[model samples]
Structure formats: C-alpha cells, structure tokens
Target chain A: DAGVTQSPTHLIKTRGQQVTLRCSPKSGHDTVSWYQQALGQGPQFIFQYYEEEERQRGNFPDRFSGHQFPNYSSELNVNALLLGDSALYLCASSQTGHYGEQYFGPGTRLTVT
Target chain B: DQQVKQNSPSLSVQEGRISILNCDYTNSMFDYFLWYKKYPAEGPTFLISISSIKDKNEDGRFTVFLNKSAKHLSLHIVPSQPGDSAVYFCAASEGGAYNTDKLIFGTGTRLQVFP
Candidate 1:
C-alpha cells in the first residue's frame, strides 16, 4: 500500500514566477489538503479539497490556490512566488467526512530564488 | 496568536528513559488533539490521538494525556530509542467547527534521545 505521493521532490523557482506542485493521496482516500512548512516552523494548513471542490482554506491569500481532480489527486499553485514562498510544501490525504488522521506525503521542497 | 503551543523548543532524554513532551492550547473549542513525529526532510507521521471525550489514549509505546480543564495535553513515550529523535508537533482540531479539517499546530519541540 503506497502512502501519499508528491511530485518533483525538489524545485527551484524565480521570483515573480509561478509554480505547481502535485500530490496523489493515499490509496482509498478521497480528500487532500496542502500545508506549508517554513524553516524551523510547523506545517501550516493551506486549504482542503473534498468532492473535487475546495472545502475550506486557511489564512493564506488568494495567490495560493489549489485544484482537486476526480482521482483524489490535488495540485497546489502558487503565483508570483516570492522569496518568502521558499518552504516545504506538504500534501496530506484523508477519508471524506473523516478529516482527522491525515496521512502526509514526503512533501516538495520549493526554493523561491 | 498560537492556539496550540509547545513551550519547549527542544528536549533531550536518555535512551530507554521516558520522554514526556507537553503541549497546551488556548482554544477550548478544540475537541481533538494529535501527536505527530517528523524526521528531517519528511512529512510528519501520526503517532497518537485523543478526543475531548477521552482523557487518555495509548498506542503501542506512545500515550497521549489530555487535561480539558487545563487545556493541556502531553505525549509520553516509554523506552525512548535513538530512532525517536525528531521534531514532535502537537495538533488540535475543532472537528465540528467552521473549518474543514483545520488543525492548528504548535511550533514543535525537537526531541533528542541520546544513547
């Protein structure tokens, strides 16, 4: 049984440019959420997607958006990235309506230069 | 404001000794608390959880204690091993509240188990 999987283990982006990170939830899971973990900081919730629609979002700005495909996979899009955007982007998955006990992915390390 | 707080930034324990990491929250609305263990450059793995209805929950070598009145919780690891050295984060969720799966996390405490 494969756990949650994320793409592009590591990435480097320039300021003012946009980047996309992908995630495939753990098997038998239907919900996916994104989080940002800055250096020496805990993971902060970004947003959650359920039933192919964004269910809830955190305090993040609109520049941080996400999409959930029918396959229970999700993508996090950060537009016009800034140096502050450099962090580890984590993806977690859980069963619908049962949001707790989310299994996390390895996460993508995004370096915004 | 940090709803969930892990006051200790780091903790060191001798291998085979007990490790008690503490966490406190300001929000009474939090109904569920969880403990996660994370290694370097990797995502946090769920360790143990306790619901507001219960005061304690134990899984294998991990045990979570919740004190509703004090709005505090703690994770106890018995016979700590060197592999247990990592950052431990405390998370709480108001499951039935406004947000969907909004888990407020503490800054985390780095646990070093010395052998």
Candidate 2:
C-alpha cells in the first residue's frame, strides 16, 4: 500500500510569484491537511480539506489556499509569495473518524527567492 | 503566539540511557497530544500520542506522559540507541468529533544518543 506522496520534491520561486504544491493522501484515507515548517521551527497548520471542501484552517493569511479532489489528492497554492514563504510544505492524511493521528508526506521544499 | 513550546533545542546522552523530551502548551482546549521524530529531509513521523482524558500512553520502548493540569507533556525513550537520534516534535489538537484535528507543533528538540 502506498503512503502519502507529494510532488516536486524541491522548488524555487521568485518573490511575488505563485506556486502550487501537490499531494496524494495515503490509500484508504479521505482527509488532507497542509502545514508549513519554517527553518528551525516546527510545522504550523495551514488548512484541511475534507469532502472537497475546506473544513478547518489555521492562523495563516489569505495568500494560502488549498484544494482536494475526489480521489483524495490535494494541492496547496500560495500567491504573492514572500521570502518568509520559503519553507517546507508538508501534506498529511488521515481517516475522518479515526483517533486523529495523521500520516505525513516527505513534503515539498518551497524556497522563495 | 506559540501555543506549543519545546524549550530544549538539543540534548546528548550516552546509549542505553533514558531520554526525556518535554513540551508545554498554552491552550487548554488542546485534548490530544502527539510526538513525532524527523530526520533531515523527511516529514515528521508519528511516535506516540495521548488524549486529554488519559495521563499516560505507552508503546514498546516509547512512552508519553500528559499532565493536563500543568499543560505539559513529555516523551520518554528508554535505552536510547544511536538511530534514535533525531529531531523530536510535540503536537497538539482539539480532537473534535467531526472536524479535522489540526495540529499545533512545537519548535522541536534535537536528540543525539552516543555509544
């Protein structure tokens, strides 16, 4: 069985540009969530998608958004990127009614130049 | 504000020693807590977790203790091995029934176990 997978292992974007990172959740899981891990810090929650609709969000600003397809894959989009946006973007998946522990992907490293 | 904090940035211990990593949270609403370990260039891997209702949870060689009144949690790794050397993180969530349990994580503590 395949675990959660993410695309574009590493990426570089210029300031003011836009970037989209992709994620495929673990098999048999339905919920997808995104997180940002800055240098020397733990990951901060971005948002979560369930049933193709956003269900929960963190303290991030509007520049961050996400989408979940019917197949349970997800995409995280960041617009008007800033240097501070440079970080490791992680994707996590879990079953809706489980104990709430999530399985995570290796993550996409986004470096805003 | 950082709701979760791991004050220790790094720790080193001889092999076979007990390693204790601590975490504190400011949010009382957080009921479910988890510990994760990460190697360079990898995502955080879930280690063990505890719910607010429970004070302790254990797995083979790994245990997590929760102090709800003090808003503190700790991960204990007994007889630590060199392979266990990695960055450890503490995460918390509200654990709602229907909503996704979004985690709030700590800065992380790097552990190095030497033989």
Q: Give the TM-scores of the predictions, in the order they appear.
A: 0.96, 0.97
TM-score of chain A of each: 0.97, 0.98
- RMSD in order of candidates: 1.8, 1.3
| Model 2 stretches astray by more than 4 angstroms | B96-99
* Model 2: colliding residue pairs: none
**Can you write out model 2's per-residue Cα lDDT over B22-92, one digit (the tens) per residue?**
99999999988889999998889989888888989999999999998899999999989999999999998
Per model, the share of native interface contacts recovered reads: 0.48, 0.62
B67: Cα error in model 1, Å: 0.7
DockQ of 2: 0.63
Cα lDDT tens digits for candidate 2, A1-113 = 99899999999999999999999999999999999999999999999999999999989999999999999999999999999999999999999986647999999999988
Q: Quality of candidate 1's docking, in CAPRI categories?
A: medium
List TM-scores of chain B, every candidate: 0.95, 0.96
